[model samples]
Target: MSHPALAFSEAEYRVRISRAREQLVARGMDALLCFAQESHYYLTGYDGGGYVFFQCLVLTAEEKPLTLLCRRPDVSQARDTSLIDEIRIWLNAEDTDPANQLRGILSDLGFAGGRVGIELDTYGLTGKNHAAIQAAMDGFCTLVDGSDIVSSLRLVKSETELDYIRKAAALADDAYDSALDTARAGVVDAEVTAAIMTTTLRGGGDVSPAGPLVNSGSRAIYGRGVGGPRPLDAQDLLILEYAGTFRRYNCCIERSISIGGPTEAQRKLHGLVRETLEEMQTAFRPGDTLGTVDDIHRRRLDAAGHAEHRFAACGYSLGATYRPSWMDVPPMIYSGNPLVLEPGMVFFPHVMVGDPETRLAMGLGNTVLVTETGCEVMSRHSLDLPVR
Candidate 1:
């Protein structure tokens, strides 16, 4: 059978595994139960969505091989993609209790009564599964929340990871250009979404983990993408928030376009929105807290009389994230967040404003990388509001 290519070098995976083990030691953890797909991919080049099931990668602090507990469907997935060799498969029988099987794996690994770190703050660990895991491991081992362990390590980009993000940025730029070219009066919003996704894949990018959020008409004033697509009006507002993903690494960009020509209010609001993002860009520097940047966003938009129209948080960190979201949190750009800016960190801060009273919206944003000098806006696209 043909095997798939891994995203990073094995040496890189080794370094990541060593670092994770070191974190476990420092935290007084004897083992780490990695449930997030990002954790598996980061540590062992494993990239399967079998995490939707009860899958876990057991990594002990001692120098030993990693063990994966998963369903049979992912047995080949693990063997082909990851360095993990000790694979235990739980059957799909009606009485199959993978949580109990996991407890058995922990017992075999000599983790009984040991403090193990579990990645609970992830989609992989569902409430039901977590409860089951707790019941199964009762009195066997102590499980602590270690959600931040792998995420903290992933915050700063490695040289190779930065290369992938740069490529993703180019694809995002092309996606915006494609959306601008395809969006027009009477065009279906879904069609425009298709153009954006097509541009990404055509440019050798993976499908975005979250949205190419295409909100049109009054929906442009909203933050999320709706399920049904609507036709663009002769004169309407369309918000296109999208990402260019390569090897699961993402760089997101958002823009609000005037479908026909803008009203004076829209044109002026867009300028302020763009200016707000520019000011936020200047503030994204090393040693500055994320709260400072958000304070600037809030203060600027509020001074312009759009306080109620703006989002609570401006943006968030971006990386190799999975479904249901692309905005890597724990360092969200919100008021009072104390996460310090650092070089090699990437962020997406959208200056969004929507006037529900006037039914108008204006937004501009891009993915940026923190640099030694300051921050570098990653997109080649202009922040200027596009007029279709």
Candidate 2:
């Protein structure tokens, strides 16, 4: 049978795997059991929605073949998308113990008494499954948290990955245009959302993990609001935060639109947001610490007298992701984070300001790549609030 088309070449995956193996060896780990779908895809080109169930990819330092422990339903998925030749299926019976099955697989692969790395902080591994695995591996192997081992490798983007991200960014710009065109007086929030989705999909964008949040009126005050059936009024504020994906690589954009001419207060907030985003671009140069960029944002907001309206984190890493959230990796733009900026790292710096008392929300943000000198904004949408 033919294998599914891979997003990257076999050489690229080999480099990724080599980096991961090096990290594992440095940490004294003999093998890595990855539960996160991102890690699976990054390592073996496996792409599927079956990660909601229990699935794991076992990567060993030794020349033994890589193995995948997945449910029967994902067997074809693994065969089709992954380069892994050894696949094991676990039955979902009430009395069946898949953890023990996994333990057996490890033992058969000569990892019975080795230091095995496991992704302990992922949703892919539930509490029940973790407990079962721990019980099964007791005295047989030593399990250690290796979540950052693979995740840290994904922080920097390759040129091929950046090309996909650029395509996703173009789609995000189109989605923003659609949102602006659909968001007007008397239009229902759902209609606007449908338009955004249509534009995104029609433009060859993949499904995003988070949202195309189309919050209007008071709901806009909440940062995490979603689209609803409510119709927009003649004088309403609409906050739109959405993303576009290409081969699971995501580029997100957030902008606020005014149904009518924006009020003076709305304009002020929008202006401040725009200014903060511009400052962020200047602050995102290589060699700068994540904390320094965050400090710049906070200082600018405080200087503008909008400290009370600032968001907790100005931005976070972005990349190929599965459900739960689109945010990726570490170094979230927050105070005290010591992660230094590096080239090839992509992030979305969103300048969000909301006043609950006034029920006003205004935001402007864009996906950016940290470059040798400064940064390059991926999404090309205007920073100014679009007045519909």
Candidate 3:
């Protein structure tokens, strides 16, 4: 059979699989059942939207080859993108038990009655599916939560990954510029969103799993509001949140703009957000803990008397992500998180503040990569709020 196109060389995949095996052995797990799309792609170069359904990559420390179990429709997808040659198909029939099939593969691979690792916290593994898998493998093996094993390994990116992230960041900057230019009095919110999307795609950005967020006036107060038909008016505040992707790797940015000019109050809020973002950049270093960076931002905002406006988490890891969100795993920048800032770790430090009483909102953020000395702001855009 003819092999499908692959993103990385076969040797790269081999190295990744070898590293995963080492992690499994260290965890005393005979095998790893990866259900997250990011994990499957990281290990096998498999990229598909079929993760909304049930699919898993079974990697074992044994001499046997890895197995990818997916629905029939995604077979070609797996063949096209991944280095996985051993493909197992589960039927769509109601009576068909994919979990049982998974058990058979595990038993065949000599993992029966052994400890197996599963990504229990991922969105790919549904609650019903988890229960079914447990029932199917009841006496055959022991299941342990190894969600962080592969994800942690993915934290530090290689040069190739960094290159893709940089490309994506460039696209994000273009999108931001488009949004700023398109946002003006008498313009519809949807129009601004369209400009951002068009510019991103025209600049070689990949299709995002989630569309860009554009909201104005009252809707702008909510951070995650989607675009609507509301038209911008003079002095209206507009919030834009979007991402750019290259080969599924995402670099996200968020910014706020005023239709005409900002009021003195809005200027104060924007200045506070700008200062917090500056502090975020300065505090992001290899030795600094994730919580330390978050604390720096939080303290600055609290001292500015905008503590109540801040979000629960200031930032999160970013990488190759699918629909619903572009956020990657672990090292959430929040208070009390002990995860250290490591070199090559990319994240988004988003500073947002909203006042319901004043009906004003301001946000400024960019994708940054933690470096040995400090952090590199991947997205190149103005820190000041743009008045269109």
Minimum summed lDDT over a 10-residue window in model 2 is located at: 221-230
Every model: Cα RMSD to truth: 1.4, 1.3, 1.4
Local error of candidate 1 at residue 290 (angstroms): 1.3
lDDT of 1 at 188: 95
lDDT of 1 by residue, 1-388 (tens): 2335678888888899999899999999999999998889888888788988889999889888799999888988788988885999988888989999889988888889999999998988899999999999999889899999999999999999999999999999888888888999999999999999999999999988887899988888888888997999999889888889999899999888888899998888888988889999998899988888889999998998888999999999999988878877778899999888899999999888888887889778888899998999998878886788
Q: Which stretches of candidate 3 lie over 4 Å from their true place?
A: 1-4
- The stretch of ten residues in a row with the least summed lDDT in candidate 3 is 1-10
Q: Per-residue CA lDDT of candidate 2, range 1-388, in tens?
A: 4454788988898899888988888999999989999999898899987778878889987656889988888888788887886999889888888789889899998887899999987778899889999999999999999999888889999999999999999989998888887888999998888887888789988888876778888888777855348899999888888888889999988888889879998888888788878887888888888787788789888898778878878889999998878888565889768888899999998888887887877888899999999999997777877778
lDDT of 3 by residue, 190-262 (tens): 9988897899789877887678878788887787856348989987888888889888899989988888899
Using alpha carbons, what is the TM-score of model 2?
0.97
- TM per prediction: 0.97, 0.97, 0.97
Q: Which candidate ranks first by lDDT, i.e. highest? A: 1
Each prediction's whole-model lDDT (CA): 0.89, 0.86, 0.86
